[model samples]
Target: MRQLLAPALLVAGLLLSGCAGFQPLYAQPGVTRDLGAIEVTAPAGRTGYLMRQHLDDAFAKNHSVAPRYTMDLALAEARYPRGVRIDNVATRYEYVLTVTYVLKDLPSGAVARRGRVRVELTYDSADQPYASISAQQDAQDRATDEAARRIELELAAWLGTTAKVAAK
Candidate 1:
Protein backbone atom coordinates (compact mmCIF):
# COMPACT_ATOMS: atom_id res chain seq x y z
CA MET A 1 0.00 0.00 0.00
CA ARG A 2 2.82 2.43 0.79
CA GLN A 3 4.41 1.87 -2.63
CA LEU A 4 1.14 2.65 -4.40
CA LEU A 5 0.42 5.68 -2.26
CA ALA A 6 3.27 7.83 -3.69
CA PRO A 7 2.34 7.00 -7.30
CA ALA A 8 -1.29 7.85 -6.64
CA LEU A 9 -0.31 11.15 -5.06
CA LEU A 10 1.95 11.99 -8.02
CA VAL A 11 -0.85 11.28 -10.46
CA ALA A 12 -3.24 13.42 -8.46
CA GLY A 13 -0.75 16.27 -8.42
CA LEU A 14 -0.21 16.03 -12.15
CA LEU A 15 -3.97 16.16 -12.77
CA LEU A 16 -4.36 19.17 -10.52
CA SER A 17 -1.53 20.92 -12.33
CA GLY A 18 -3.25 20.23 -15.62
CA CYS A 19 -6.43 21.83 -14.33
CA ALA A 20 -4.51 25.05 -13.64
CA GLY A 21 -2.82 25.18 -17.06
CA PHE A 22 -5.34 23.30 -19.13
CA GLN A 23 -5.44 24.86 -22.57
CA PRO A 24 -7.01 22.96 -25.41
CA LEU A 25 -4.49 20.56 -26.92
CA TYR A 26 -5.87 21.22 -30.38
CA ALA A 27 -4.31 24.70 -30.36
CA GLN A 28 -1.37 24.43 -32.74
CA PRO A 29 2.02 24.70 -31.10
CA GLY A 30 4.48 27.55 -31.87
CA VAL A 31 1.73 29.40 -33.71
CA THR A 32 0.70 32.67 -32.12
CA ARG A 33 0.06 36.24 -33.28
CA ASP A 34 -0.34 36.01 -37.01
CA LEU A 35 -1.43 39.67 -37.01
CA GLY A 36 -2.96 39.40 -40.45
CA ALA A 37 -5.24 42.23 -41.50
CA ILE A 38 -8.90 41.59 -42.21
CA GLU A 39 -11.55 43.65 -44.01
CA VAL A 40 -15.28 43.26 -43.39
CA THR A 41 -17.84 44.67 -45.81
CA ALA A 42 -21.52 45.16 -45.13
CA PRO A 43 -24.44 47.10 -46.62
CA ALA A 44 -25.46 50.77 -46.51
CA GLY A 45 -27.22 52.78 -43.73
CA ARG A 46 -27.45 52.33 -39.95
CA THR A 47 -28.42 48.70 -40.06
CA GLY A 48 -25.42 47.98 -42.23
CA TYR A 49 -23.14 49.90 -39.92
CA LEU A 50 -24.43 47.93 -36.97
CA MET A 51 -23.80 44.73 -38.84
CA ARG A 52 -20.30 45.89 -39.62
CA GLN A 53 -19.68 46.51 -35.95
CA HIS A 54 -20.93 43.05 -35.15
CA LEU A 55 -18.67 41.49 -37.77
CA ASP A 56 -15.59 43.38 -36.66
CA ASP A 57 -16.03 42.42 -33.00
CA ALA A 58 -16.88 38.83 -33.78
CA PHE A 59 -13.86 38.44 -36.05
CA ALA A 60 -11.48 39.84 -33.48
CA LYS A 61 -12.93 37.81 -30.62
CA ASN A 62 -13.12 34.54 -32.51
CA HIS A 63 -9.62 34.72 -34.00
CA SER A 64 -8.03 33.31 -30.87
CA VAL A 65 -5.41 31.16 -32.53
CA ALA A 66 -4.17 33.96 -34.78
CA PRO A 67 -3.65 37.56 -33.73
CA ARG A 68 -5.26 39.99 -36.13
CA TYR A 69 -3.19 42.91 -37.40
CA THR A 70 -6.13 45.13 -38.37
CA MET A 71 -9.83 44.77 -39.15
CA ASP A 72 -12.10 46.89 -41.37
CA LEU A 73 -15.82 46.88 -42.24
CA ALA A 74 -16.96 48.70 -45.35
CA LEU A 75 -20.60 49.59 -45.85
CA ALA A 76 -21.66 48.39 -49.27
CA GLU A 77 -24.97 47.23 -50.73
CA ALA A 78 -27.25 44.60 -49.21
CA ARG A 79 -29.85 42.50 -51.00
CA TYR A 80 -31.52 40.05 -48.70
CA PRO A 81 -32.73 36.79 -50.12
CA ARG A 82 -36.41 36.19 -49.39
CA GLY A 83 -37.02 34.48 -46.07
CA VAL A 84 -38.88 31.24 -45.78
CA ARG A 85 -42.53 31.68 -44.93
CA ILE A 86 -42.87 30.96 -41.23
CA ASP A 87 -45.78 28.88 -39.99
CA ASN A 88 -48.18 29.83 -37.17
CA VAL A 89 -47.58 33.52 -38.08
CA ALA A 90 -47.85 34.46 -34.44
CA THR A 91 -45.59 37.50 -34.84
CA ARG A 92 -46.95 40.94 -35.79
CA TYR A 93 -43.75 42.49 -37.06
CA GLU A 94 -41.13 40.11 -38.46
CA TYR A 95 -37.50 40.84 -37.79
CA VAL A 96 -34.61 39.70 -39.93
CA LEU A 97 -30.89 40.42 -39.79
CA THR A 98 -28.35 39.45 -42.41
CA VAL A 99 -24.61 39.75 -41.98
CA THR A 100 -21.81 39.25 -44.49
CA TYR A 101 -18.11 39.56 -43.74
CA VAL A 102 -15.07 39.37 -45.95
CA LEU A 103 -11.52 39.02 -44.72
CA LYS A 104 -8.68 40.22 -46.90
CA ASP A 105 -4.95 39.92 -46.64
CA LEU A 106 -3.76 43.52 -46.60
CA PRO A 107 -0.33 43.31 -48.20
CA SER A 108 -1.20 40.48 -50.52
CA GLY A 109 -4.47 42.03 -51.72
CA ALA A 110 -6.21 38.68 -51.58
CA VAL A 111 -9.38 37.41 -50.03
CA ALA A 112 -8.67 35.15 -47.08
CA ARG A 113 -12.13 34.38 -45.81
CA ARG A 114 -15.75 35.24 -46.48
CA GLY A 115 -18.90 34.23 -44.60
CA ARG A 116 -22.55 35.22 -44.31
CA VAL A 117 -25.01 34.68 -41.48
CA ARG A 118 -28.72 35.49 -41.36
CA VAL A 119 -31.27 35.30 -38.57
CA GLU A 120 -35.05 35.77 -38.62
CA LEU A 121 -37.00 36.54 -35.48
CA THR A 122 -40.72 36.10 -34.92
CA TYR A 123 -42.76 37.45 -32.03
CA ASP A 124 -46.33 36.72 -31.06
CA SER A 125 -48.86 39.41 -32.03
CA ALA A 126 -50.57 39.26 -28.67
CA ASP A 127 -47.32 40.12 -26.95
CA GLN A 128 -46.95 43.40 -28.86
CA PRO A 129 -48.63 46.80 -27.90
CA TYR A 130 -48.33 45.73 -24.27
CA ALA A 131 -45.65 48.39 -23.75
CA SER A 132 -43.07 45.72 -24.54
CA ILE A 133 -42.28 46.03 -28.22
CA SER A 134 -38.80 47.22 -27.35
CA ALA A 135 -38.27 44.10 -25.30
CA GLN A 136 -39.17 42.00 -28.30
CA GLN A 137 -36.69 43.91 -30.45
CA ASP A 138 -34.00 43.34 -27.86
CA ALA A 139 -34.77 39.66 -27.82
CA GLN A 140 -34.60 39.49 -31.58
CA ASP A 141 -31.30 41.35 -31.61
CA ARG A 142 -29.90 38.93 -29.05
CA ALA A 143 -30.91 35.98 -31.16
CA THR A 144 -29.39 37.53 -34.25
CA ASP A 145 -26.18 38.26 -32.41
CA GLU A 146 -25.97 34.67 -31.27
CA ALA A 147 -26.40 33.39 -34.76
CA ALA A 148 -23.73 35.72 -36.13
CA ARG A 149 -21.43 34.75 -33.26
CA ARG A 150 -21.73 31.06 -34.02
CA ILE A 151 -21.07 31.60 -37.70
CA GLU A 152 -18.07 33.78 -37.01
CA LEU A 153 -16.70 31.28 -34.52
CA GLU A 154 -16.77 28.55 -37.11
CA LEU A 155 -15.21 30.80 -39.73
CA ALA A 156 -12.43 31.84 -37.39
CA ALA A 157 -11.59 28.26 -36.57
CA TRP A 158 -11.23 27.51 -40.22
CA LEU A 159 -9.20 30.64 -40.81
CA GLY A 160 -6.85 29.76 -37.99
CA THR A 161 -6.31 26.30 -39.36
CA THR A 162 -5.68 27.65 -42.82
CA ALA A 163 -3.32 30.34 -41.62
CA LYS A 164 -1.33 27.89 -39.57
CA VAL A 165 -0.96 25.51 -42.48
CA ALA A 166 -0.12 28.29 -44.88
CA ALA A 167 2.50 29.73 -42.59
CA LYS A 168 4.26 26.41 -42.45
Candidate 2:
Protein backbone atom coordinates (compact mmCIF):
# COMPACT_ATOMS: atom_id res chain seq x y z
CA MET A 1 0.00 0.00 0.00
CA ARG A 2 2.85 2.47 0.83
CA GLN A 3 4.69 1.81 -2.42
CA LEU A 4 1.55 2.34 -4.55
CA LEU A 5 0.62 5.52 -2.70
CA ALA A 6 4.09 7.05 -3.19
CA PRO A 7 4.00 6.62 -7.01
CA ALA A 8 0.48 8.07 -7.18
CA LEU A 9 1.49 11.14 -5.20
CA LEU A 10 4.57 11.67 -7.37
CA VAL A 11 2.51 11.52 -10.54
CA ALA A 12 -0.05 13.95 -9.14
CA GLY A 13 2.67 16.38 -8.07
CA LEU A 14 4.27 16.27 -11.50
CA LEU A 15 0.98 16.98 -13.22
CA LEU A 16 0.25 19.91 -10.92
CA SER A 17 3.70 21.41 -11.46
CA GLY A 18 3.30 21.21 -15.23
CA CYS A 19 0.26 23.47 -15.11
CA ALA A 20 1.77 26.04 -12.72
CA GLY A 21 3.01 28.68 -15.20
CA PHE A 22 1.64 27.46 -18.48
CA GLN A 23 -0.16 30.08 -20.50
CA PRO A 24 -1.69 29.63 -23.94
CA LEU A 25 -0.04 31.98 -26.40
CA TYR A 26 -3.17 32.79 -28.39
CA ALA A 27 -5.25 33.31 -25.27
CA GLN A 28 -3.15 36.29 -24.17
CA PRO A 29 -5.12 39.52 -24.22
CA GLY A 30 -5.11 41.53 -27.47
CA VAL A 31 -3.26 38.92 -29.53
CA THR A 32 -6.24 38.42 -31.84
CA ARG A 33 -6.93 42.13 -32.00
CA ASP A 34 -3.30 42.90 -32.77
CA LEU A 35 -3.27 40.34 -35.53
CA GLY A 36 -6.41 41.75 -37.08
CA ALA A 37 -4.89 45.21 -37.24
CA ILE A 38 -1.99 44.28 -39.52
CA GLU A 39 -2.06 45.07 -43.23
CA VAL A 40 -0.13 42.82 -45.57
CA THR A 41 1.46 43.90 -48.84
CA ALA A 42 2.80 41.30 -51.19
CA PRO A 43 4.51 41.35 -54.56
CA ALA A 44 2.67 41.27 -57.88
CA GLY A 45 2.10 37.88 -59.50
CA ARG A 46 0.06 34.75 -59.11
CA THR A 47 2.09 33.50 -56.18
CA GLY A 48 1.96 36.89 -54.51
CA TYR A 49 -1.77 37.11 -55.01
CA LEU A 50 -2.28 33.70 -53.47
CA MET A 51 -0.08 34.61 -50.49
CA ARG A 52 -1.95 37.84 -49.92
CA GLN A 53 -5.28 36.07 -49.97
CA HIS A 54 -4.13 33.52 -47.42
CA LEU A 55 -2.64 36.14 -45.11
CA ASP A 56 -5.73 38.29 -45.31
CA ASP A 57 -7.87 35.37 -44.31
CA ALA A 58 -5.56 34.42 -41.49
CA PHE A 59 -5.38 37.94 -40.06
CA ALA A 60 -9.11 38.62 -40.44
CA LYS A 61 -8.32 42.20 -41.47
CA ASN A 62 -10.96 44.87 -41.05
CA HIS A 63 -10.58 47.51 -43.72
CA SER A 64 -12.96 49.98 -42.03
CA VAL A 65 -10.43 50.73 -39.28
CA ALA A 66 -6.97 52.18 -39.71
CA PRO A 67 -4.13 49.70 -39.54
CA ARG A 68 -1.61 49.89 -36.70
CA TYR A 69 1.07 47.96 -38.56
CA THR A 70 1.98 47.06 -42.13
CA MET A 71 3.76 43.95 -43.35
CA ASP A 72 5.72 43.89 -46.62
CA LEU A 73 6.63 40.60 -48.23
CA ALA A 74 9.26 39.82 -50.84
CA LEU A 75 8.51 36.56 -52.57
CA ALA A 76 10.75 34.26 -54.62
CA GLU A 77 9.77 31.08 -56.41
CA ALA A 78 11.87 28.38 -58.09
CA ARG A 79 11.30 25.03 -59.69
CA TYR A 80 13.76 22.23 -60.35
CA PRO A 81 13.47 18.93 -62.12
CA ARG A 82 13.76 16.18 -59.51
CA GLY A 83 13.73 12.85 -61.37
CA VAL A 84 14.85 12.48 -64.96
CA ARG A 85 14.23 9.63 -67.34
CA ILE A 86 16.87 7.88 -69.44
CA ASP A 87 16.24 10.31 -72.31
CA ASN A 88 16.74 13.28 -69.96
CA VAL A 89 13.02 13.97 -69.63
CA ALA A 90 11.87 15.14 -66.20
CA THR A 91 9.42 12.90 -64.37
CA ARG A 92 9.09 14.81 -61.11
CA TYR A 93 9.74 18.40 -60.11
CA GLU A 94 10.44 20.27 -56.93
CA TYR A 95 8.89 23.67 -56.26
CA VAL A 96 10.28 26.03 -53.64
CA LEU A 97 8.60 29.22 -52.46
CA THR A 98 10.21 31.66 -50.07
CA VAL A 99 8.88 34.85 -48.57
CA THR A 100 10.80 37.40 -46.50
CA TYR A 101 8.56 39.68 -44.48
CA VAL A 102 9.05 42.89 -42.55
CA LEU A 103 6.50 44.14 -40.06
CA LYS A 104 6.49 47.88 -39.35
CA ASP A 105 4.69 50.05 -36.84
CA LEU A 106 2.56 52.53 -38.74
CA PRO A 107 2.43 55.03 -35.91
CA SER A 108 6.19 55.34 -35.40
CA GLY A 109 7.36 54.12 -38.85
CA ALA A 110 9.73 51.72 -37.08
CA VAL A 111 10.34 48.09 -37.90
CA ALA A 112 8.69 45.83 -35.35
CA ARG A 113 9.55 42.31 -36.56
CA ARG A 114 11.12 40.54 -39.52
CA GLY A 115 10.82 36.92 -40.48
CA ARG A 116 11.21 34.53 -43.42
CA VAL A 117 9.19 31.46 -44.25
CA ARG A 118 9.95 28.88 -46.94
CA VAL A 119 8.00 25.90 -48.26
CA GLU A 120 8.98 23.13 -50.65
CA LEU A 121 6.64 20.88 -52.58
CA THR A 122 6.96 18.15 -55.18
CA TYR A 123 4.62 17.20 -58.00
CA ASP A 124 4.69 14.66 -60.75
CA SER A 125 5.35 15.92 -64.25
CA ALA A 126 2.88 14.65 -66.80
CA ASP A 127 3.33 14.25 -70.53
CA GLN A 128 0.30 16.42 -71.14
CA PRO A 129 1.06 20.12 -70.98
CA TYR A 130 -2.19 21.10 -69.30
CA ALA A 131 -1.83 18.42 -66.64
CA SER A 132 1.71 19.54 -65.88
CA ILE A 133 0.62 23.12 -65.52
CA SER A 134 -2.23 22.16 -63.22
CA ALA A 135 0.08 20.14 -61.00
CA GLN A 136 2.53 23.05 -60.69
CA GLN A 137 -0.28 25.42 -59.88
CA ASP A 138 -1.50 23.07 -57.17
CA ALA A 139 1.98 22.98 -55.65
CA GLN A 140 2.15 26.75 -55.68
CA ASP A 141 -1.16 26.99 -53.87
CA ARG A 142 -0.07 24.50 -51.21
CA ALA A 143 3.25 26.24 -50.62
CA THR A 144 1.63 29.63 -50.27
CA ASP A 145 -0.96 28.33 -47.81
CA GLU A 146 1.67 26.64 -45.64
CA ALA A 147 3.92 29.72 -45.61
CA ALA A 148 1.00 31.90 -44.60
CA ARG A 149 0.14 29.60 -41.70
CA ARG A 150 3.74 29.61 -40.43
CA ILE A 151 3.98 33.39 -40.68
CA GLU A 152 0.73 33.84 -38.76
CA LEU A 153 1.94 31.56 -35.98
CA GLU A 154 5.25 33.38 -35.69
CA LEU A 155 3.60 36.75 -35.65
CA ALA A 156 1.12 35.66 -32.99
CA ALA A 157 3.94 34.38 -30.80
CA TRP A 158 5.92 37.59 -31.20
CA LEU A 159 2.90 39.69 -30.40
CA GLY A 160 2.12 37.61 -27.35
CA THR A 161 5.63 37.95 -25.93
CA THR A 162 5.74 41.66 -26.69
CA ALA A 163 2.52 42.17 -24.79
CA LYS A 164 3.91 40.27 -21.81
CA VAL A 165 7.11 42.32 -21.82
CA ALA A 166 5.19 45.56 -22.06
CA ALA A 167 2.98 44.54 -19.18
CA LYS A 168 5.99 43.88 -16.96
Q: Which prediction has the highest lDDT against the true structure?
A: 2
Question: How badly does each model clash, as a count of residue pairs?
Answer: 1, 0
After superposing candidate 1, which stretches have Cα over 4 Å from the reference? 1-37, 61-94, 125-136
Which lDDT tens digits does candidate 1 get at residues 2-101?
9999999999999898898554423544222332223445556655556556655664533433434333333222222233346643434455655555
TM-score of each: 0.51, 0.88
Q: Go through the candidates in order and give each one's C-alpha lDDT.
A: 0.53, 0.93
Residue 31 of model 2, lDDT score: 86
Please, what are the lDDT tens digits per residue for candidate 2 over residues 1-168? 998999999999999998988899888887888888999999999999999999988888878778999999999999999899999999999999999999999989799999999999899999999999999999999999999999999999999998898889
